[model samples]
Target: MKRATSIVALALAALISVYALFLRPKENSIPSPSPELLAAARPLDTYDFDLVLHPDSNQLGVTMHACFQNRWSETLPDIVLRTWAGAYASPETSPAASDELYNRCYPNGFSEGGFVLHDVTINEQRVTPTFDDAAHTVLRLPVTNFEPGQWCEVSLRMVLTVPDCLHRFGRSQGVWLLGNCLPILSVYEQGAWRTDAYAAIGDPFVSAVANYNLTLSLPERYTPFTSGIFEHANGLYTTTLHAVREAALLVYEQSVTASIQADGTRIVCIGRNKQQAHKPLQIAKEVLKYYNQTYGAYPYPVLMVAAVPFAFAGMEYPGMIWVGENLYGQGLDDALELTVAHEIAHQWFYALVGSDQFRHPWQDEALCEHAMLHYVRARHGAGAYDALARLRIAAPMQENIREGITPGSPIDSFHDLEEYTTVVYGRGAAMLQALDVHTNGRVDDFLKEYVRRHAFALASRQDFEITLADVLKEDMRELLIDYLDTSM
Candidate 1:
């Protein structure tokens, strides 16, 4: 009887070991960041950036004094910074390549090259930069001399030669849409630096919320739209922005500004809208009102919408948005209005509640698409929402069904932009819509609580799932597995 009891106990222990080793999810297998690191970097990362734009020479002169606090327990090591401009020079190119129909960025061919860096320094001392092209779009900076919990101040000067193309970091048609032109710190995760490259599809960036103080010098006649508020002084314009991703600057010629007061938030529309200049600002005002009431208040004092012919239909920054000229060229129709709302929705999902856009893009892109649907339902009638659902969600999802793709897959999984749009954006939104139906309108409560829970900080998929389960008072594992294809 004793021997039989001992045999049973050994079998049980062996079974437990097998489950722990092989059956555990990958997310659970990865180690969590140290609590001491989290506590040390308690509040925010900050940057003091100075940039000068010379449109005639197509050059940008930048000097950044970035102070980043180490967010890991392991001390006396190096840090990684991403030079996203190099992705343009790489063979894979930008996200526009995966775009099937629209070829606005490289119309004439891929002739233009990328950016250049010079005068790198660490803590007022010069250091040689090491390139790691294969690992990620990054440059390694040695910080082995510094201790843990220390704020390392690294300064570097760089020059970006803007190509003659309408890209995220190019100038075309007298408009400059400069995105990811700055070398910012890479996100640290799971006791390692996330050094993923800019991919051919999806916005391949993972970042932390940081404050920015910018001083931009530009030509006298050109009006520049920036991610932060500006005040012109002594031949240079200085802007102070807080709690956001990297800064972006868009310069335009023959542009005008219109202002609207929505709940004491100043909304500004910049640049020419050949179709209807006032329409962009009008949509911005209305969308702002609805989102402010539903989700949360637009925390920024000012929001600028610049009507420019950009590579993408619309792009969102912290306090500014870029409205494509393609939508405006055809007039202020449904497409233009919704695109504005979609970008504005990013303010809540992306700018406010940050996520790993590279690894878990569905966190923001998918959520923004669904949030746009909510806006359509609130502003327009049910009919308008149905139409949008058919055009944006239903149609795109049909293609994914034919392609055998799932919505919750990571951004790196998709090869084409259409598939990304169909699966990640469209199907993900559909999943949310279905969840709202399944939960009987309780999804709104979950989202409102989500915003309140993760405002001004980064939240992972697990964080979101835990919050949902807490709200529902039940296990949401089956629902997430079925919809998001998640194992966590």
Candidate 2:
């Protein structure tokens, strides 16, 4: 009897060990719901933003609530606001300078990319606003000399114009949506501030306060899609927005498909009125469902995608994707679906959780690329994504390419076609694949945790690495960096 009892005890011990090894969360980890599940719950913070479109003036009245944190460096120059001049010129061929031509579509003396002061309490003597031209940004203003860590409701109103009709300027000239309309604070990471990689401008850092509510009034013929909730609408195209989490508004052509999903998510798109965009529409619905099933439900409960022509090859706007003629021009089969999927991936990587587009491009952008590839793999078969990843690794990096090596090389520097191809886009795609291999399938859970922990906070590269290490194993450090930093 004693021997029999001993045998049963050993069996139970073995089973318990195996279960723990496979199912346990990390050390000191917070007990929380899975991302797939947590997404169904309410978010901790909410923000409200409004964009009053002015097609006649060729500008947008950009207003934002919530708040901001100022951390501009002393050395950078004051950001030049307004329409970008010759922004489409090739980065390699164009002169190394930044200048914007004001279209004067909106009211003047609104403080061109600079700080402005409205009426406050005279006796209150609100904190005086300050701007250092040398830093290229507004430092910090007390506003009301309020207590530290106190939430003060502040609003910034500005006017922005589209530069050109073909690219980014299309948002101004064409009937479409405009993203990143308001200027906030820049991220101060790794000892200095982070700049934007796409525009060669300063980084606007405010990831924590992404929650926002926005309302836009538009033509009856033009339907508007925004980031936050849509409370009610009146004539002339109106929507009341709330929970301003990130800064973005999606504008789409009145045509296309518009409907309320069963999950309470509003899915809209602007594509071929005929059958060309049908598959993309179907694929889009599936992608959204799959995203909720695999990771988490979209907290906003509303996602809008507009198919439109953009300056860049493809641009990811907050609520919609400015699908370019180049994309649909490629035809609406695989290429179009791939492009759409990539943009949808951004809704999570770039939209929900903000990243410093100016610096640390890999942190969120690469992750989005990886996430996109995962979906591509699912739709086309895993082998396809794996093969594409292999092609990326095969393309070697050019150490000689001017200044991809500086401490912040490629971080804040604007990479045009040539530079963007090798580093930001192609290499980033490859690195994600490599990271997948490094995690040994452990990334599934890590990503689930990552978006959960830093969903609405400023996350840095170091923070990502450390979190990854903690979630999996400290030993993964060398493995992850080896694949990400090096050619192999």
Best by lDDT: 1
lDDT per residue as tens, model 1, 111-225? 3546677888888888888888752358888775566678888999888777666667777778888887788898877777777867767778777877788888998988776
Quick one: how many clashes does candidate 1 have?
Answer: 0
Q: What is candidate 2's CA lDDT for residue 480?
A: 50
Candidate 1: global Cα-lDDT? 0.76
Q: Which regions of candidate 2 fall more than 4 Å away from where they truly are?
A: 1-51, 62-144, 167-169, 183-198, 201-206, 228-232, 236-245, 252-254, 260-264, 272-279, 317-319, 330-332, 396-409, 486-488
Specify the highest-TM-score model's number.
1
